[model samples]
Target: MSKGQITKARILHQAAELFNQQGYAGSSMSDVMDVTGLKKGGIYNHFKTKDELSLAAFDYAIATLAQHHRAVLRQHHHAADRLLGIMAVFSSFIDHPPVAGGCPLMNTAIEADDAHPALKARAQQAMTNLRKLLCHIVDTGIAKGELQPAVDSDVFATILISTIEGAIMISKLYDDPVHLERAIAHLTDYIDEYLRI
Candidate 1:
């Protein structure tokens, strides 16, 4: 990569961590400067505005998560196994999160509510993609007879995502891992008992 490209990449990495932890509204340009070691002109050279940087950082964060999910999903062929693996991915958020604060999707969704329309839309799209992925996995499982034929992919996917996200929120709130652990263990049993054919 060129020097400019490398600098831009570094800015995105640092900004992503900053935005994810402190949030877009909560974060200031000074924080970005501190994280990236870049002055205003340096940052503005790459991103025209803070809004632009926020959107880019969110996209970068989502891509990082997608990469991790793809790697784990590739290892499991069956739908149940894939779902379990996905859960394991979320579980890793406790100690080894892809970003700093918490689940970017959840964090963004909560913070980017009414005022930040662009960021809110991006968060919604990211969440839609996740739900679609889970639904696709369920569909594949049913087709392969790994999962029950009667399952409603939408409902199943919603349950899994909501439960996992909620657990993440609780875990982060109390700075405790037990809620996340129990949630994952329960989901595992839910998969084995209800999802498997």
Candidate 2:
């Protein structure tokens, strides 16, 4: 990468961490400058405005998260195993998150609320992509005869994601991993008992 490319990536990464933790409205260019060791001019040279950086950082965080998902999912060929692997990946977030704050989707969704339309849309898109991934897994499982043919991929995916994301929120809230642990354990049992064929 060129010097400029490297610096821009650095800015994005640092800014992503800052924004994920502090949030868009709560964070400022000065905060980003402090974390990135870059001046206002330096930041603006790469991003036209804080909004631009905020969106870019969100994308960066999501990309990083997707990479983790790909890495873990690649190791499991069975659809059931892949779904379990996805749960494991989220379960690991308590100790080692892809980004600093939490699930970028959850964090962004909550903060974006109705205030930031652009960010709210981005979060929704990211979530939809995730749901699509789960649906794909379920569909593939059905084709492979590894899952029940009658399983509704859309509804199943929604339940899985909603359950896991809620567990993550609860775990993060009280600084307790048990909440996620219980969720993952139940999910694993549920998938094996109901989804697996």
Candidate 3:
């Protein structure tokens, strides 16, 4: 990457971490500067507005997450394993994220309520994409005979998405990661019972 590109990338990545950890309100631009070693003009050069940076930061989070998950899923050929691997997004390993930044989607969603429409929309789109991915996975399982033919793929997808977001929300609110375990257990059970046909 060019020097400018690398610097912009660093700013966005660190901004995501700051936003995830301290939230939009709590995380000042100075925090991002501290983390990224970028000056005011350096940041504003890349992101014209805080809202723009916020959106880019969220996309950075999802891009990182998607890259990690795609690598993990590629290790397993079976649809079941791939599906469970996706569920592994909730495992205890995620509790203490290597990034040490919480889930950006959940953080953005909670923090942007009625405050930043652009960020809120981005977060919602991320959730919708996740739901669509789960539905697609379920469809693949069905085609591969891993899931029952009678299954309501849409409902299954909705529940999985609901459970995941709910768990993350509660976990963040309660300052407990155990809620993620509870949510993952439920999602795993659903897959085992209905998708393991």
Q: Output the number of the lDDT-best candidate.
A: 1
Q: Candidate 2 on 1-197: residue-level lDDT in tens?
A: 99999999999999999998999999988899999998999999999999999999999999999998899788999999999998887888899889998888889999998999999999999999999999999999999999999999999989888888899999999999999999999989989999999
lDDT of 3 by residue, 1-197 (tens): 99989989888778888888888778788888898887888899899988788888888887877776677667866666777887776463356553456666667788998898888888889888877777777788789887787777788877776778788778877888889888888778877775787
TM-scores of the candidates are 0.98, 0.98, 0.89
User: What are the runs in model 1 whose C-alpha is more than 4 Å off?
Assistant: none
Rank candidates by lDDT, best first. Answer: 1, 2, 3
lDDT of 2: 0.93
> Candidate 3: where is the Cα deviation over 4 Å?
92-94
The 10-residue segment of model 1 with minimum total lDDT is: 97-106
Q: Pick out the ten consecutive residues of candidate 3 with the lowest summed lDDT.
A: 90-99
Please give, for residues 43-93, the per-residue lDDT of candidate 1 as tens digits.
Answer: 999999999999999999999999989998989989999999989989999
CA RMSD of each candidate after superposition:
0.7, 0.7, 2.0
Q: Rank the candidates by TM-score, best first.
A: 1, 2, 3
